[model samples]
Target chain A: MTDSAVMVEAKGLRKVFKGRRGDHTVAVDDLTLTCRAGEVFGLLGPNGAGKTTSLRMLSTVYRPTEGVATIDGHDVTSDPESVRKSIGFLSGNTGLYPRLTAREVLTYFGRLYGMDDGAIEARIAHLAQLLDMDFLEKRCDKMSTGMKQKVNIARTVIHDPAVLVLDEPTAGLDVLAARTIVDFVKDCRTRGKCVIFSTHIMHEVERLCDRLAVIHKGRMQFDGTLEQMRATHGHDLEDAFISVLEAA
Target chain B: MNARRVMVIAKKEFKDVLRDRRTLIFMVLLPLLVMPVMFLGIAKFAQEQQSKKQSRTLRVAVDSNVEPMITALADQWMAENSPRLMITSAKIGLSFPAAGGDRKGLGTMIEQVRDMMDGGADAASLADLDPDLVESGVRLAREIDPADKALFDDASTISTFRTKTEFILIEDLEPSETRLPAGVEVPDDLPESWDGEQLARAIQDKTIHAAIHLPSNVFDMLEDQRASVPFSVFYDESVSLSEEASDRLAAFARIVGNGLLEMRLADNGLAPQFAEPIVFEGADMATPSRRVQAFLGGLLPYMIIMFSFFGAFYPSLDLTAGEKERFTMETLLLAPVSRMELAAGKFVVVFVAAVVAAVLATTSLGLTFTQGILPQGVAAGFDIQFEPEAVMLTAVLLIPVSALFAAVLLGVALLARSFKEAQSYTAPLQFIVILPAMAAMLPDLEAELHLAWIPFLNVSMLMRELLKGNYLWDFFGITMLSMGLLTLLTIWGASLIFRRETVILRT
Candidate 1:
């Protein structure tokens, strides 16, 4: 934490969702964290563990309940448009219009980010080549899940933003597609982009993440590196995760 | 906010809408083909039914007392008319006594008459009249005027004796009413020399087609001067062939009247021209073209306005609820363009589709009237001409109408949670549009200055008057301003909806 240059910083971040009958559900309890440029930050949690809510707040899709979050020096609450411009977001269930071809889809997003025609075309072609999405020139509705996943990945990076927030990005992908996504995350980190990825798969954390936070029942239970976690709770990452949850 | 980004969004929306088979079918193919097919099918069916009705011969039962007179009338009518009229004599039952019946029996008879007039009796099983009963009143009328060779000259004498006479005439009657027996009612004020028109109208209220009245001097008139007697024939108007039958009977009466006049004039050593001093020349102001144009004027605007609703329907749903259902809306929201730009881009697609549909519908209606579907005489009479400039102006007017419709529909559809829900939301919109769109159909509704500023009604009325070759510039200006303001209002409303996160995220 001391060595890493902060790319994302939050102080006392909280989120409350209003429910039916005038009740409120605390989705994220008072939590604070930081992720640095050129490092992978993992928000490891079980289902409904407030991971997606926090990610949404960071992406500026939702505002923080009590405090503030800043992405690349832009406040999430006041400068949401700027924060949105700085980040590329993807979720496993984030959908693409089935009617458009992969290239058209990417070009659409690139232009929305105010990219000129030449840049958009160039970006689409480059991403299509890299992600092997050229085959997705056919209708998207006819594409296999892995093919759709690749197209989704290409769409996310088309704007070349400084930060990437992925929510369970590999939740349903086959092995080959999952590997491609993991590799893309590593490549994003290498490009000096701040990457915060949320996942429940422990192997994903063990392989790619540099620092990790474990949250449960809307509260943070652990916050440290994989080695620090191993040093405190034994070598097995899965067992340590389970131990942390059990203790909490 | 960038133009390039907006254009990109527009292009993508177009692709998405076109790729959807249902949207494509609804927006383009259905309207393009369905209207012509529906119109032509209805027209063909109507023509076939008319031809069938004209060619078929109807069998009408007549009372035996008036059998000879009716046969003569029918013969003369059939000879003069194109469609053949066939008459069959059958005895209709009369429960009334030969002279004066008991009061209770008369009441029962009147009740039976009422039932028969109310369309209760079967036509096939009607009772035959007694031959002696049939000729009793006719014989009585003849017996009163033996010596006076000029009894027909005394009009009051016939009126006096008609109260006592039971003789009747039935002509050109509906089969449904042929089951009723005659001579049941002699309402005291009924004129002895009445024609059938007033009687026919009265009987029509009770479902009776025709009844006959015979004056006492009818036989005298026939014998002494060979003159036509004054008699009445009554019939109902709502019977299927009543109009044709009424026309036939009127023609027969006119011929008989002319013949009687001619006979009397000849006997008095005068000419028929002396009786009719003046000739009437009828002039009709409407040309064939004007008639056709009037009908087209009413129809064209309605069709154009209706197409606007249909054209807006699918794209509105597709852009909003359809995208939401497919899970692509979040992706769209994540794009760097502002919400307003996305809304505007979608609005453009729907607006274009609506305008195109409207134009096509108007063109089809115009072609239907001009392309030989209507008779040349009718087309010529109507002078059904629309200038190219007027059409262009109407097209310009449609832009605002289309815009207003598209924006309103898009806003409403965005609030819906699914395609079916959006359809439910927009279905009543057609009802909202239809009445105002049909302004031209009501010719009595004049296009007032204030009405010129009403939303859909103004466009409808203005288009109608414009197509009729009228250019009401003040009305036109008001319509343009009104439509423009309404369009802006709707677009603004749609923008507000776009800004509502709750509406956009409604699941």
Candidate 2:
């Protein structure tokens, strides 16, 4: 889509946490990955397989114990504020303020992003209509799981951020709600926006991922297209996913 | 450190906290109503119980022969003691008296009534008196000495005098028929001449709340030249009715005893003044307001400091650990705001809550005094004068105290993974201030150099001193400095914790 297209790059990212008893757990280790504008990148891993940890490092939510990542042209560590302004991040661990109405949640973030009231109001209107969020005035705590997910999705993109990093955003959503997120991810890619999504769902990886990375045990196991993974590892995508885990 | 961003964050927190019904209850309404209602309630309740106690009728019994004698004693005591008090000459002299219905101020009438009670005419010369001179009659009565009975001879005709102690003397019943109230017992062996045991049983059973026991042939024993009479008085100490009855009966004995001694002294040509050498005088100089302020000082500062701690408690938890619990903290951190800005925003909400609570408590107390809401006796003793400058200085001290509270609470609460865990951690914090805050409330704890450096104690003590109209400038400077240092250190520490991904993402 663009002559120069790389939007995110991670090189040798490492994160180690010291446990309460002084044991060390390496959450992410020496992982290298990249995603470009107009690309839907899938980070596939099981629970605690460094998928969320890597994404957190990329989003600047956590600092790398070693190495670095950059969003667009800004280094995440050196220019975190700019990096933050560029990326919309969502995960199972991130949620809406229940006491705040959906509209309030959006407006608050918009203000934090240095948006004027007029711009925030207009953007809220557009997102409300686009997301089918008729319950925007309802408090986040009052919403059903599906409705709450929609509010979360609206909050993630309220600033119209250029890069979207989603960590299992649809993990527990109903079918229709999951479809809304899937459509939104595809829509983000269609508008030449960069997307890095992590999930355990194989079907989701098959239907939406353009290029993928498999991380296991705090290390990247594979990084390539699904067809290339299938050719090298196994025929079935699920089998290839499991084989990669086993080999690791 | 964008002001607008910090302001935006602060405004948002205010909205969220204010909308929380529980927060508003502690922050706004409690401070507005508690003191006034509680003091007024206590005053009214105490007044009611007192009136009830004074008007109560107590059951009494005596040896059948003693009833008429006791009745005669009551009348004779009144007749002997109602002295002939002379009214001092005043400016407004009337020809014998004023018109039939001349109006006088209640103060003037009360003054005249007081003169009559002290040993003046039955009808006082109700001329305008210098209120100061009206009090001098007590001095005059003491100086004249009752030995000179002629000095108190009544000069003006007035209404009849009245005695203060009024009692309904029920007819005497037999020792057995005068049943004890409930839990009473008599000794098995009893003396025939002085059955003090039966009298004790009568009082214990509460059948007769009070009783006087006389010896058999007691009149003959008394009439004998050198013999003495032995008898006993019985009453339950715990029963007010019984206690009051004993007091009145004791008074009659005292009057009769004194009359005997005086008559003996006169027969020997001596004066009673030989035994009564000391003239006692008592003066109270404290105004009502100062008394109330001194009393309140020992208690209110503790409450205010405790409330300031509470004001920071929930909010700091809700914003830090609470965010982690709600899953919203990460979302907030992801926004392009610094941890300090976030911390500052949280700090503002809690500080406002603390200051608002303190101000409201002060306002409530001020209203309680100014509104005349206490019962008459209590109100008469109160004259609270709030110095505006002192209050303003006290407010300055609240700043660092509240800041330290917010920062320390937020920093500690952020370490927890949930609201309940945060609560346990913060609860012990309330205890940390307990010793120091209460130390300031101790009336004898003077503001010393060493105490000025102890953080919470210093603030509490400084606030207390400021409230009492003492500036303690050097102590104030040091306390503010120490508090400022503590606040900065706490804020820095909180910012450090805010920067920690381990704490922010504890769950």
lDDT of 1 by residue, B263-380 (tens): 5576789976998899898987877677767777888888888887788789989999888787777677766667888898999899988987777776665665557654443334
What's the C-alpha lDDT at position B313 in model 2?
Answer: 76
Candidate with best TM-score: 2
lDDT, residue B345, candidate 2 = 87
| Model 1 docking category | medium
Which lDDT tens digits does candidate 2 get at residues A1-248? 33548999999999999898999999999999889998889999988899988998888888899998999988989898999999999888888888889889999999999999999999999998998989978988899988888888888888888899999888988899899899999999898889998998989989888999999999999999999999989989999999999999
Docking level of model 2: medium
lDDT of 2 by residue, B1-507 (tens): 988889999999988888776667777777777787888889888887765543443455655555334333333322332211221111000001122423232213333345554555322342222222223333333333344334334412222112210000010111122221111112222233336687667667765666665666654564462565543567888876578667645543554455455555666798988657887888778676776777766666776777777767777888888889998899988999988888888888988888887778777777787788876678776667757887888778878877888889989999999989999999998888888988766889999978999988887887777777888999989998999998899899989998888888887
Cα error, residue B324 of model 2, in Å, equals: 1.5
Which 10-residue span in candidate 1 chain B carries the lowest summed lDDT?
B82-91
Q: Can you give the DockQ of every candidate in the order shown?
A: 0.50, 0.70
